[model samples]
Target: MKLVLVRHGETASNVRMVLDSLPPGPPLTDLGHEQANVLADALADEPVVAVCASTAVRAQQTAAPVAARHGMAVRVVEGVQEIFCGDLEGRSDREAYGVFVKTASEWADGRLDLTLPGGENGRQVVDRCLAAIERITEGVTGGTVVLVSHGGAIRLAGQALAPNVTASLAAGGLLPNTGRVVLERDGAGWRCTAWSGVDIVVD
Candidate 1:
């Protein structure tokens, strides 16, 4: 199975750099909508059979035009939402973002046991995201499936599921709005083929 995990488009919270992880979150800005349409156009040639999205309104909004282009509805699946910010929810200060980045770095460094302060652990985040993917791919035997999700969750899940996802790539930075992390799942395991448009070379 081929999975394309896409980060949701920009929102006011994204521009403000706030940790808005909860559901029904901010809608996309005009630029974000344009980005989504561009994303749809970009994938027009792919064998896209289904589209899925997290519960976030931004994600659903991003998936809408893509699914519409494919003549399908966006499947809102559970467990693929953004990394919960918990106590840091809605915070935009540097300190808050600093803590989030530190925790993300720890996860990328293989510290899956460490919990984000007042938030989920790396293991929890990865597990749920993987489960969501499994659910989305169930009964699907072929073509590409797009999972519209958040940056933090996609990074964690990609790092956890793909052996080709290097620590540097996993920890590098937040995926830009509508950015994609493409993976292929086979009998062996999952392997990342691309991250944010850069192809991943297997070691």
Candidate 2:
């Protein structure tokens, strides 16, 4: 099974520097829609069997075009959602961004117990995300699956599972919106097939 994990397009909260990870978080900005279209076009020929997205509004919006092209419904899976922001949900300060980046990095480094105030632990996020993917591609022998998720979730999980693939994606310790990585099922784990943005027009 091959899973293409994509980050949702940018939102107003993104520019505001706010940590908006919850559902109905923030709508995509105009540029974000354009980014989504580009992402869809990039995967137009990818034999996508199923399109899954986080419950967050932005993730759904990002996955809609791709699902439409393939005539598949966007499956809103629970485990693939963004990292919970907890007390830093509404902050737009550098401190908030710093903490977010640090937490994600730590999670990638295998700090499963780490989390923000009132937030979920790294183990919780990765286990659920992988479980959701496993359930979706349970019986599929060879096919592609598209997953629209958040930056934090994708960065930490993608890097953890596919270190070499996400190496370029680590820009100042954050992932660019709409960037995606392809992973193939390897035994009980995953292996990166294509690093994020190798053929992408945008970084």
Candidate 3:
């Protein structure tokens, strides 16, 4: 099984730094739509058998075009939703930076027990995302499965497969808006095939 995990396109929350400020879900911005288009074009040729996305609006929007082009219905998966940010939702950057830094620091230091106020810890996200992947891979054998999700969820999914990569994956591992990373599973386990997004031009 090959899993292609993609982060949603840029959103108003992203540009305004209100991502952590807003609620858990928000629709994509105009630029986000453009990013989605590029991403859809990029994966148009891959033999995608299943398309799944987080219930969040941004993730759904990001997966729509690709699913449409592939003629596959998207299977909404709650497990891939962004890390629950709790009280930090909708707060300004200045107000949230300290919390983000703190959580990130703990993650970097290998303290998996630390959880953000009213939010999920890294380990929880990793476990759930891996479970979701396992479920998705059950029947499918060879074709790619595209998962549209948030940055944190993407990181968690990768970490589930490669626990030793926690620090590096948490250190902003180049998954820009609509970016993708591919992982392949053999008899042993999942292995990363590619990292980051590629430019796709559609005529």
Candidate 4:
């Protein structure tokens, strides 16, 4: 089985960095729509068996174009949704950066137990996303499966696939907005086949 993980396109919240402060839902912006379209075109030749996305509007919107192109239905999975920002939702970058930095520092320091106010911790997000991946793998015997999700969620998913490799959240991995990362099962483990949008070489 092959997995293609994609981050949703840009959004109003993304431009304003207010996603963590709002009520947990925000639709994509016009540019986001364009980005999704571009992504759809790029993946037109891939054999996608299923399309899954986070329940958030931005993710759903991003996945819709690709699903349509491939004549696949979009499956909503709450587990792939972005990390909840709690009290930080809807706040500007300047207003939330300090807290975000503090929380991120703590997270980097192995304090996975800490949760954002009204939000879930990295450990919880990873657990649910891993379950989601397991479910997808079970249903797909071969061919590519696409998952459109939030950046943070996708990052955690990548970590799950490559547990021994140390990575930074700020490095953005290879899956940028509208970008794709491919993972394939090998023997008793999973291996990264490709990571698009980053300069890193992929086999």
| 63: Cα error in model 3, Å | 0.4
lDDT of 3 at 112: 63
RMSD of each: 1.1, 3.6, 4.7, 2.7
Off by over 4 Å in 1: none
Residue-wise C-alpha lDDT for candidate 2, range 84-200, written one tens digit per residue: 889888898888878877776666656779878888888888788777877887898778999999877876677666545444354334557898877887776677765555642
Instruction: Tell me the whole-model lDDT of each prediction, alpha carbons only.
Output: 0.90, 0.80, 0.76, 0.73
User: Arrange candidates by lDDT, highest first: which order?
Assistant: 1, 2, 3, 4
Give me the overall lDDT of model 3. Answer: 0.76
Please, what are the lDDT tens digits per residue for candidate 3 over residues 116-193? 788778788777888887787788888889999877678667756743444665555757888787777745677666
Estimated TM-score per prediction? 0.96, 0.88, 0.88, 0.85
Error of 4 at 168 (Å): 3.0
TM-score, candidate number 1: 0.96
Q: Looking at candidate 2, what is the lDDT of residue 154?
A: 78
Worst 10 residues of 2 by lDDT: 165-174
Poorest lDDT segment (10 consecutive residues) of candidate 1? 184-193
If ranked by TM-score, best first, what sequence of candidates would result? 1, 2, 3, 4
What number of clashing residue pairs does each candidate have, in the order they appear? 0, 0, 4, 7
